[model samples]
Target: MNRLTIAAIAVAVLLVTAASSLFTVQQTQQVLITQFGQPIRVIREPGLHAKIPFIQSVIALDRRLLDFEASGEEVILGDQRRLIVDSFTRYRITDPLLYFQTAGVAENGIRGRLASIVSSALRRVLGNEALLNVLSVDRLRIMNEIRDQVNREAKRFGVDVEDVRIRRADLPEENTQAVLSRMQSERERVAREARAEGAEQGARIRAAADRDRTVLLAEATSNADILRGQGEQEAIAISAAAFEKDPDFFRFWRSMQAYREAFSEGGDSRLLLSPDSEFFRYFRELPTVTP
Candidate 1:
């Protein structure tokens, strides 16, 4: 064949290749075949695909999961308390045709609408719980409710919501301060009460100890008195035993004691006595023993 004729055939082949032939679908992608802007087929399987290139355009869609992290939002709880709720969700596009029909485009299509829906769901679920519950244990239930509600609305958009979860849900900073102050006040009150109770207990213990001490001291004093009296009685009994052994000596000792007591008086201190007093016998000269 001539060179000109060969070059003409190559040009025609190139034009047909560009306008009427091949397509590619990846493992993580799906595609829609549109003819004159109208969807004709949905292609999910991956690899090179053939199409009427000029008559049909292939639009690719991702089949993998996507995520959206909701920003902090103010929500009212069941107890009429306000809180900031931040959350996130995982989702996937299940039906390309339906997704395109409802959401349009791809990842960009459903995000805005999903945000609105999830926000609304947050209000609906959290509204049944107190602010503390929203910040605490009931959070999981709220997430579950959001997922269910989101999935329900997503049917028309061919989007499947896999999960919804709380990232951060908390009271506002001002409200948190208020709560802390109230807690501190309550703690201080409790501390004061505890101290007062301790003081009262101390007083009771001290009173009981004093009463015991007083009783012990009184018992000791009474016992000492009894012992002293017994000691005096014992001394008198010992003296009586000595006197029984020698009556004359005891009488002589008694007469001497009486004479000394009667005669030995100070000038300022006086005593009255008879000259023939029995006490004089010991003091005066002894009588003669005449035969």
Candidate 2:
């Protein structure tokens, strides 16, 4: 070949080599340099970086926080209740070198291991808690405990667990029906008790009212008898006074009142006395007319 053709070929080789040697590290990524399938160093700073053309290779790992979700797991609480718990975790690759050694270069490699760690922590912490604690405000404390435990185990894999949360927690299908039945029975029992108490109160009130009515009627009858006795005594006194003033006239008046009563309309009275009886003295002879 001529010198010009050889020089052109050499320039092309240099350009290809320059392109292979340079790489850009983004703000969200970290680079791991490996030589012949073995790790050498990790680069965390962002911006332009260089490596040997064909001898070394760069594996980029995400430096930002990562999220992982675990499937529903059955856990037994301290109250002996079975619950299906769905949980999620937030983590970060704090030590890239250890992460590369343990989890490999792919981000997906750590998912299985992290999920196992999180589930274990969830069981350990939740096993000591009651169902009420899991569903109440105390759940915050339980989650913190789980996060701390998971974080401790995750550190070995170069992962720092920031938070662990239970997305949902529910009783098993079999337990749900049983719980509902129990609740219904309990409510029925309370209703029955309330009805019994109400009935008892109603009976008591009725009894009190009946007793007061009887007492009031008895008092009224006694008062009426006393007034009648007093009036009869006054009438007797007045009649005695009239008799003293004029015996003949008073006798005639009394006899006339007797006759009217004995022969009053709608009366079925019959007299068996003789015609000359003293009760008929006024009928046989009229009294002298007073002026």
lDDT for each residue of candidate 2 in 65-113, tens digit (9 for 90 to 100): 8899999999989888899999999999998889988988776789989
- Which model scores highest in TM-score? 2
RMSD of each: 9.1, 7.2
Candidate 1 stretches with Cα past 4 Å from truth are: 1-12, 15-20, 191-291
True-structure Cα RMSD, model 2: 7.2
Give the TM-score (vs. native) of candidate 1. Answer: 0.63
The stretch of ten residues in a row with the least summed lDDT in candidate 2 is 279-288
Q: Candidate 1's error at 114, in angstroms?
A: 0.3
Highest lDDT: give the candidate number: 2
- lDDT string for model 1 (52-164, tens) is 86788888998999898888999888998888888898999899888888888856669988898889988888888887666567667767888999889877788899999
TM-scores across all candidates? 0.63, 0.66
Q: Local error of candidate 2 at 272, Å?
A: 39
Check candidate 1 and list the clashing pairs.
none
